[model samples]
Target: MILFENVSKTYPGSHEALSNVSFHLHRGDMAFLTGHSGAGKSTLLKLIALIERTTRGQILIGGQNLAGVTKRKIPYFRRNIGIIFQDHRLLLDRTVFDNVALPLIIAGLDYREITRKVRAALDKVNLLNKEKQLPATLSTGEQQRVGIARAVVNKPPVLLADEPTGNLDPELSEEIMKMFEQFNQVGVTVLIASHDLELIKRMQHRTLVLGKGKLIAQFPEEDS
Candidate 1:
């Protein structure tokens, strides 16, 4: 489970990125976060990913309070969390297989195990054949799938996506969201921060809205 209790963040100029935000995401739950460009969506995801520390309040992930998690221990904290960035941060110089294998490699998994996991993740995204291809050789949508594969290669229990569909067309966005649904169906907690309201409305998942460093609303899809 993920919990935020009275969390807030402020920049050097006193520009608030998050203000007294508090919420709970249960294990295996799926939710979306939406708002305009300056909304605290990205900041919220950052806090969850441990990429940014909350200026105040507490965060609990998987029963561990983030306040007690030291900076040096951050890497260990990330072992069970997966993050997908808007940019698809693939290594242009590497093959898709290697890129996706990064996390497993960092964990020093056996080569055979890494290969098995990478293949499984790629298969989930239907990009198994593109293993030898460079990220630059693929289209934007395919590259994004590569990113997703990389994020899930470790089989993390929690997944965080920041504007994952920002670079895709509506159709592609639907496809990607469906992929996320597939992951959630298999029991991975998923939280996506995006601005594609019209596109996501059809998917019918819960949505958390943010504005000016504060959570304004939460839309829980009745269909789910």
Candidate 2:
């Protein structure tokens, strides 16, 4: 449900992050974005998330042009897209349940609904029992799972993860990828920007590869 047509992003100093990158990710598609460090993977995701504006070209999400989205509407626009970061950005002092519940709370949901959704999200990441625990008390992998739980707690239609498995061991990385796969199976559009080529190969999903500031290749190729 994401389409980028001849999109390019250039920073203030004339550094181009993306150069005419064009791709269409249909609804429910699961894909990976891969490239070397400074290859513009993060910039591409930022453009889609509207965290940064494109220097040229256009981006359409679910048929809505992001260029038309006003600054006042960004919060509402983001409600449909869930983002997970490599570093588990959980509140150090809050319990896992509270962290996962934060988004729902901000959305003004009722307490009972928030409780139910938080529990369900925690269960998905196998962290239901740790709901009362602080982030510092959890293992590295558990902390990452907590991040995932918080991202999906709102059940957004599109999920974007940046280097989600970067800090975890191979086993944990695989586990995290599996969780993304599970979400995709249930129809959540999944696009992950990661540098782990080995892991991306193992997943065998469509991948967009970048180099410098251009889309260099697309694995398995798309049909005409």
Candidate 3:
């Protein structure tokens, strides 16, 4: 489970990116974060992933507080949390297989193990046939799938996506959402930041809306 208790962040110039933002996501739950640009959507995810730290309050993932996690321990802490960005962030020079195998390789896994995991991830994204291709060679949607495969290659229990479908058309956007749904079904706690209201409504999952650094509403309302 992920928990945020009265969290807030302020930049060097005292610009508040998030304020007293508190929410809870149970294990295996999938939810959407929606807001306008600079609504703290990205800031919130960054906090959870430790890319940025809260100036106040605390964040806990799976019952462990993130406030005390040191710089040296951040990488290890991140290994179990997968993150996807608006840009696919693939290496244009690398093949899909190589791209997906990067995290495992960095962890010092043997070649055979890397190959097995890479193939399995690619299969999940239905891009096994494109393993040998470069990101530039695939269509926009295919490139995004490659990115998804790379993110999940390590089988992280928590997945966070920021504007994952920002560049895709509506049809492609829905397809991408379905891919997230597939991951959530298999027990990955998923949180996505998106601006597509239509898409969010269509998915019908719990949604947390942020407005100017504060959480303002939740869809379908929480149980009493």
Model number with the top TM-score: 2
Per-residue error for 73 in candidate 1, Å, reads 0.6
Q: Which ten residues in a row have the lowest lDDT in candidate 3?
A: 215-224
The whole-model lDDT of each prediction reads: 0.91, 0.94, 0.93
lDDT of 1 by residue, 1-224 (tens): 88889999886686989999988888898999999998889988888888888899989998999888899999988988999989999999999999999999999999999999999999999999999999999999999999999999999999999999999998899999999999999899999999988976888888888988888887763232
Instruction: Give candidate 1's error at residue 30 in angstroms.
Output: 0.6
Per-residue lDDT of 109-217 in model 2, one digit per residue for the tens?
9999999999999999999999999999999999999999998999999999999999999999999999999999999999999999999999999999999989999
The lDDT leader among the candidates is: 2
Q: Evaluate candidate 2 by giving its C-alpha RMSD to the native, one decimal.
A: 0.7
Q: Which stretches of candidate 3 lie over 4 Å from their true place?
A: none
- Pairs that collide, model 2: none
Cα deviation at 148, candidate 2, in Å, is 0.6
Ranked candidates, highest TM-score first: 2, 3, 1
Q: Each candidate's TM vs. the true structure? A: 0.96, 0.98, 0.97
